[model samples]
Target: MPKSVAGGTKWTYFASSNAQNSRSPEVLFDLLVSCSSEQGFSQVAYGALTDAEPTRRPEYLPAAVTVNFPSAWRERYAERRYNAIDPVVRRTTMQSAPFLWDQLAHKYQLQPGEMRVLNEAKEAGLKHGVTVPLFGPFGQLSVVSFASSFDDVDPEYRLSRLNALAWQSHHTFAEIAPSSEGKCHMKVALSEREKDCLRWVEEGKSSCEIGVILRVSENTVNFHLKNAMRKLETNSRTHCLAKAIRPGLI
Candidate 1:
C-alpha cells in the first residue's frame, strides 16, 4: 500500500464493490462519496450517461451531493455558471486519459469565483484528484472522479488503480443507466446499419454523405438514424450517439 493511502485502504473495497453493484447514478454517487470518505478525501463528483430522448441536461443526473463543499461556493458556481468555463471538465471532454489538477493550472487562469472554489478544494485537504473519462457505444462520454486531500499521496498510482476501478464501474453503470429497454436496458444494442450510421455521424457525416458511403439514399440513411434513435430512446441524433456509445451499442 502507498503510504499516502496507508490508513485509508478500506475505501478500496467499499468503492470497488459499490461501483460493481450500483443500481442508478444516485447509487453510484452515494458510493463514490463513501469511498472518498474512506480515503480521507473531502470531495468527489461524477457524471454518466442517462436515458434522455434528446439528451437534455435533465436526463443527465443532477449533481448529487456526496461531499460537503461550502454551500456558498456551490451556489456561486451554479449561479455564475462556471460549468461553461470549467477547465477541468472541458479537458475531460477532450481526453480518453485521466487528468490531474496541476495539468490545467498553467493553461487556464481561474477567475475570482473559480479561484475561490479551487481554494476551497485545496483547503479541504485535496492534494490531488483523478478524473477518468469513459467512452461508450455511440458517442457517449462519462467521467468518474476520485480525489483526496492528503498531499503525501501519489496521484499516478491512484490513477492507475482507480482507472481499472473506473472501467469496472462503467460497465456496471451501463447495466443500470437505461431502465426501459428490456433486453437493451443499460447498454445500447445497435445493429450493423444503425452502428454505421451513428459512426458516420460522429465523424461529422451529413445524411447525404452517409448515404453515399452506405450506397443508400439520404432518406434511407435518415431512416437508419431514426431507428437507432428509437432503439436508444433518444429524441435526437446527438443524444443517441452519446447514449448508444456509452452503453456500448456500436
Candidate 2:
C-alpha cells in the first residue's frame, strides 16, 4: 500500500524493500544517492549506531559507518569525540521523527560545545541537512543523512521526501548487513517507560489505550514500543513477548 506521509509524501511499503533486496548495501546506497542527486544533495552518510565503542575510549562514544561525508569533518569528529555533543546523533535513538540539523540545534539551544561541533561541521560544507533514524527489529539502530551546500533548503518538503527515501535505503542495508558484536557486546537496555509499555502490550492493550493509561501521547506509546522492540531484539510482537517473558522482564 502507498501510504501518505508528511507534506503529501507517498510511501510504497513493498516497493523500497523489494527493489534492492537482490543487491549489496553499497550498491543500494549508491542507488539512493543517485536518485537524490536530482535534488542537489552531493553527499550522503549512513551510520550504524551499533558501532559505538565506549569501553576503550577515555569518554564513551558510539562509532558510526559514514560514507560521502567530508573526510576532514569525520577525522575531527573522532578526534574530539564530538558524539557526546552532536544533537543529531544523540536524538536518533530516542526520536522517531526525522530532524533537520538546525531545528534540533535551536530546540536544544546549542550550547557553546554543541555550537563548536556544528561550526566545524559547517566549515566542512555540511551546514544544512536532514537525518532520518531507523530502529531495526533486532535491537539495531542506524541513520541516513543527506547533506548539501545550499543553505536555502526547504525542510518541510525536502525532509518529507528524504525521510521516506532514507528508510528505503535502511531497509536495503538491513538486508545486506549481518549483525555484529559491538564493544558493549550487551543487549540494549530498555527504559522503565518502555518496560511499562511492553507489560501493557502483553496484557493486550492497544497503543492508544496504553497512552491513556500512561497519560502520554499515543505517538509516545508507539515510540516506547519501537524502542522496546529494538531492545528486545525481536521483529514480531508475539516473539517479543515470549523473549521478554523468558527473561522475566515483563
Candidate 3:
C-alpha cells in the first residue's frame, strides 16, 4: 500500500490526544517504546539508561541525559562528537512535543555536514527515527525515541499507534518513579507562582518573554524566579531546573 499522507486529520488526531493528557512522562515514553513493533521500528529509550554512576562524584548524573541509542553508537557518536552535528537532538531540545522523521527531514535541508551523519546512521541500519523530547514540568529534559529501518513508512498508522501508547507509558512511569530523586524522600515545595515560573523556564522562556506572556513586569518575573531558586536551594537557573525536576517541585 502507498504511504499515507503525513499532514492530515490523522496526524492532527494524534497531536490533539497527546496535548490533552500529558501528565505522565514515563507513560508517554513507555507507550512510544512499546509501539516500536507496530510502527515498524526497533529499540527505544528515554532518559539515561546508564547505571554507571560516576565514581568520585557518584551524584553527578545530570537530570538531563541522552536516552537509548546503543552503547557502542553512543561512544562512537561521542568520540566523533556527532551530537553537535546531529540536528535532531539539537532541534528537539527546543520543542515540547514529539517529532517524526518527516518533520525534521523536510524542515531543514540536509547540508553536507548533516548528510554525512545521516549516512552514518543509515549505515548503522537506523533509517528513520522519531524523537519526543519531554521537558518535565520541573527542569528535566528527557528524550524518548524510536528507530526503524524503513523510510517513507506509513506515518498515519505509526502516529496513531504511538499516540495511543504515549499516555499509558507516561502514567505508569510517573507513578512508579516518583517526582523526586529518592522517589519519596526529596520533596521541594514551590508556591503557585514559583511553579509557574519554573515551568515556563523549563520550556526555555526568558524572564522578559515570560513577563510579557504572564502580563507581569520583568522584575516581577525575576522575583518569582528568585523565590523559586531560594525555595529549591539552587545557585543558578539551570541548577534550579535540575533540582526542581530531581525533587519534583514543578
What is the C-alpha lDDT profile of model 2 across 1-250, one tens digit per residue?
Answer: 1223221122233324455456454455557676555556667877767653111222222444437677778778889888888877777777767788778766776678878887778889986878887665456667778887777766556765566566544544444455322112345567788878766665556789989999999999998888777776655443354344333454
Q: What 10-residue stretch in candidate 3 is worst by lDDT?
A: 52-61
lDDT of each: 0.57, 0.61, 0.54
Task: Summarize candidate 1's per-residue lDDT along 1-250 as a digit string, tens digits.
Answer: 1221221233235434555455555665555466545545445655543332211135332442132444655566667676666656667767757777755676566566555555665665556777777665566566666767677767665554455445444444445545323124444567889888877765546799989988999999999999998876656565565455443555
Highest lDDT among the candidates is held by which one? 2
Please tell me which model should have the higher TM-score, number 1 or number 3: 1
- Tens-place lDDT digits, model 3, residues 1-250: 1121211223224324654256444444434444455567655644532232111112222322224455666667668878668777677766656677556757777777676777777677677777655444445555556677667666544653443233223323443453433122445678887777766765556899889878999999899899877766554554465455533355
Off by over 4 Å in 2: 1-22, 51-63, 179-250
Alpha-carbon RMSD to native, per candidate:
12.0, 10.5, 11.7
- What is the lDDT, from 0 to 100, of the residue 227 in candidate 1? 93
Q: Which stretches of candidate 1 lie over 4 Å from their true place?
A: 1-26, 36-42, 49-70, 106-117, 123-127, 179-250
Total clashing pairs in model 2: 2
lDDT of 1 at 157: 51
